[model samples]
Target: MEQMTATGVSPKEVRQRADDAGMSILRLDPLNTWSRVWLPDNMDDAYIATVDTRQDRVFALCAELGCRSISLNATFPRGSMSIEAIIEDYAKICAASAFDLDCSLEFIPLWGGRPLAMAWQIVQGAGASNGGLVFDTRHFVRGKSDLADLRTIPGDKIHCVQLNDGPLVLPDGVTTKDDRYDRKFPGDRQFPNVEIVRILSETGGLNQVGAEVFSPMLKDMSAKHVDFARLSGRGAQDSHGNVRKDLFFTRTGSHRPLRFGDGTIHPCLWS
Candidate 1:
C-alpha cells in the first residue's frame, strides 16, 4: 500500500487499520517528499539532515509495518546535477535501507528517469544489492522505453509493476501533466498491458503487479462506490489469467495472489 494513505495517522494506527482490514503493506511510496534529490537546494546540509530524519522515520515505519520495500522517486530538476552525484546519493539511500528493505526507483516521464535505461543506469551504478526499479505501465508507454531495454533487466531488480492504461496516442493539446490525471483502468484502452506483462513475466520482473489508476472519476467516488473485485477480475481476464499463473512468491517463498484492486491506490508485492 502507498504510505500516503496513512498521511496523518500514526504508524501504530496504520498497522492496526491494515490488520483490521486483513491487509499487509508490502511496500511504501515516495521515500522523499516533493523536493527532488537533484535540486541544489536539497543538497544543502540542513536539507540533507532533513532528508535523513525523514528516512529514519520511514525506515522505522517500515520496520513497524513489516513492509519490505520503499519506492524512491528519481525526479530531476531543471538544472543539472552530475549523474555520478545522483548515483552516489542513490547508493547512499540504498545502503541505508539495504539491511532492512529494498529501495526501488520509480521513473516518471516528463519529470525525470523516464526511459528505463537511465533508471537502470542509476541502480546499476549504485551497486547496492537491494536497489531496484518500479515498472509503471503508463510511464513505460508514455516514456517510450525500449522493450529491448526492459528485456535486459533482471527480474529481481523490478520491485513492483504498477498496471494502468491510457491512450496510445495523445490528442493534441494534451500534455503529460493533463494526461496523467486521466488514466484509465488496465485493459480499458489500447495500452499494451498484456504484452508488457508477458515480457516482464519472461524476464522474471513480474513479482508484484497492481493497479494504479489516478483518474478524477475514481477520485470523486467514495470507497463504497468502488468495486475492487470487479476491477481486479477484469485485469485478470484481460491478461487471460497469465497474471495468476505468473504470480510472484514472497521472500519467504510463499505464493500470494496478486490483488490489484484492493481498494488501495497502490497495492504492492513484497518480493
Candidate 2:
C-alpha cells in the first residue's frame, strides 16, 4: 500500500496519465485470485488482502478503474476439489461480476490447469460467455503441450496471449519458480516462439500479445524498466540494451506488447 501511494499514484492518476498521452488502458491486474490458490502457506498479507477480496469487490474495483478484465489462473494439484466443482465455482464468480467482463485463465505447468486442454475444459464446462484461456508461450513450452492442442481451440475462446521464450536446456530437478525466472525474450532462444505466434495467427486469436520476459539476472540490471518512447517507435532496449523488435510485430500489422516495469506483462484486447 505504501508503494502504491508513495508516488501519489492511484488508478485515477494512471488513467489520467494515459489519457494525457492519448493512449487507452485495457486491463488492470494483480487484482483477482486463482480461486483455490489464494491461501498458500506463508503468503504475504498484502497479497492475501487482494486475493481474498470477493469477486464482487474486485468487479466493483475494476468497474471504477474502467478496465473489464482481471488476471486469473487455477490452483496446482487442486487438492480435493473436483473439476466439475471448480467449473461451477468459476461460473458463479463470473456471474457475480456485476459487469460484463472477460475472465481469462492462465495455465501453468505447476497448476491444476497445467495443460491448455484442461484449462479449456474447465472454461467450457463453466459455460460462462466471458470465460476464456490465456496462452502463455513459456507455459506452453514448459507443459510440452502440442501446438495442435491450440489449433483446435476457437479463436474467440482465446482471450489473450503472453509471448515469451524458454531456454533450450532444462536444469536438473526444475521447479515452477525456476520456470518463472527462466523465461527468455521471445526469439532469444530456441523455443519456437515464431511458430507459436504463427499458430495463434492462423487461429485469428491474436487480439492481445504480451512479452513477459522474467529473469532474476535481468531484474538486477540497472536499466530494468522499459522506456515507453523507445518501445513505441519499434523495439524497446531491454535491461541488457538489446533491441527486441521481433517480440512486437510479425508479418502482421504493427502491434506493441505492454511490458510493465518490474518485468511483468499483461496484454489487453486491442480494438
TM-score of each: 0.75, 0.75
lDDT of 1 by residue, 210-240 (tens): 6777777765656543654334343343232
- Please give the lDDT score for candidate 2: 0.62
Residue-level lDDT for 91 in candidate 2: 81
Model 1 worst lDDT run, 10 consecutive residues = 248-257
Each candidate: what lDDT?
Answer: 0.68, 0.62
Off by over 4 Å in 1: 1-8, 33-53, 219-227, 230-243, 246-271
lDDT of 2 at 201: 60
Q: On a 0 to 1 TM-score scale, where does candidate 1 land against the true structure? A: 0.75
